[model samples]
Target: MSGPACVIRSDQAGICLFVRLTPKASRNAIGDVVANANGQMQLRVSVTAVPENGKANQVLIKLLAKAAKCPKSSVRIASGQTDRNKTLLIDGNPEELMAQISQLSGRTDT
Candidate 1:
């Protein structure tokens, strides 16, 4: 009941983001929010790290930290560590971090 947002949410701690990660993609980037088959919208993120040995998750966290304008250590996989769909918690000013994550969801430069 704490995480799992369609895009991002402001919490007492910081911000929560729902992400759908794609490993070994053409490139690493943050994409817009897209709806899945179940009609749940998730932010799209891609990394080049192979999905073996939890490397992809680490890459994702770094990328997200950069995109969210937060320190790398501020990002953490709150849930779905082994799954493409994950919840990343960013530790920072909730308002500022949410703005950054919103820019991610509203991206049109893909």
Candidate 2:
């Protein structure tokens, strides 16, 4: 079954992303795409890079940007830079954005 589209919330600063990151995995892939009962898509990523020297964070930004179909410069790690869970700022429609992510994750859109 296809996952539901993501919902983007506007903030005083910008759009926020609730990202769940997995460090030191075999590879980076969007997995377990689920929208919370509240309608927020909780994204899980498996990354091979260890969380050190901002390597994983940088990788996460690039990968997430690609998935969101936005320029890398458009995707910014707003908070939790030093933590596994991060909040991202991406400027775009949540549904269209999630569709791109599903494509990148090899999931067929419904």
Candidate 3:
């Protein structure tokens, strides 16, 4: 018997990021940076608004947009809308965007 099958594609445009969100904090700010066992950059953000009614999501989008220096409409929540870990679809070069994020977070991609 074969186990669950999966196919990995190489044409993917965006990178999937794992983020830890802290709602109801003082303001929207990026906190400690950690890397999972897989060496993925994990960031924590403290949002001022509660998680009710998609407020946290909006806050995250705004923060990311500001960080990316793009309009809010350009950054979109692709998945994990109801979960802390989210995947954002940014309409631009992933490599360049990742570089910008690395510069902002002071972390080098390894």
Candidate 4:
């Protein structure tokens, strides 16, 4: 996958992403990486759905699957399903996918 927030790891299975989600935002979009109070970086993502009944999570998965150029089934909520901070498992080539996502995260400094 990647590291430092937008992505947590790049492994043979897939990429692991830590996302700080904002539900019911004005629109659905993926923003930049931001540090939490603990100084841990996370990707800032917003969705229009309320964070109930896993709707927001579903939306996030759909969005991410599209963004990562993978099937929706390939994106899974590895953890933090009921919380704003979520972990995602994205299936595919980690190196290639991370490169694409790095651009989406606006990770020029990296």
Candidates in order have lDDT scores of 0.81, 0.69, 0.65, 0.84
Weakest ten-residue segment in model 2 by summed lDDT: 1-10
- Compute each candidate's TM-score over C-alphas: 0.87, 0.68, 0.75, 0.90
TM-score of 2: 0.68
Candidate 2 segments exceeding 4 Å error: 1-14, 34-41, 93-95, 98-110
Off by over 4 Å in 3: 1-14, 35-40
For candidate 4, the TM-score is: 0.90
Model 1 quality (TM-score) = 0.87
| lDDT (Cα, 0-100) at 11 in candidate 4 | 63
Flag regions of model 1 displaced more than 4 Å. Answer: 1-5, 107-110
What lDDT, from 0 to 1, does candidate 2 have?
A: 0.69
Error of 3 at 35 (Å): 4.5
lDDT of 2 by residue, 1-110 (tens): 22234433444443566677888988888776556556656567778889999889888888888777688887888778987666788777656665565565455542
lDDT: the better of candidates 2 and 3: 2
In candidate 4, clashing pairs total 1
Which residue pairs clash within candidate 3? none
Candidate 3, residue 33: how far the Cα is off, in Å: 2.2
lDDT of 3 at 97: 65
Candidate 4 lDDT at 96 equals 73
Q: State how far residue 90 of model 3 sits from its true place (Å).
A: 1.5
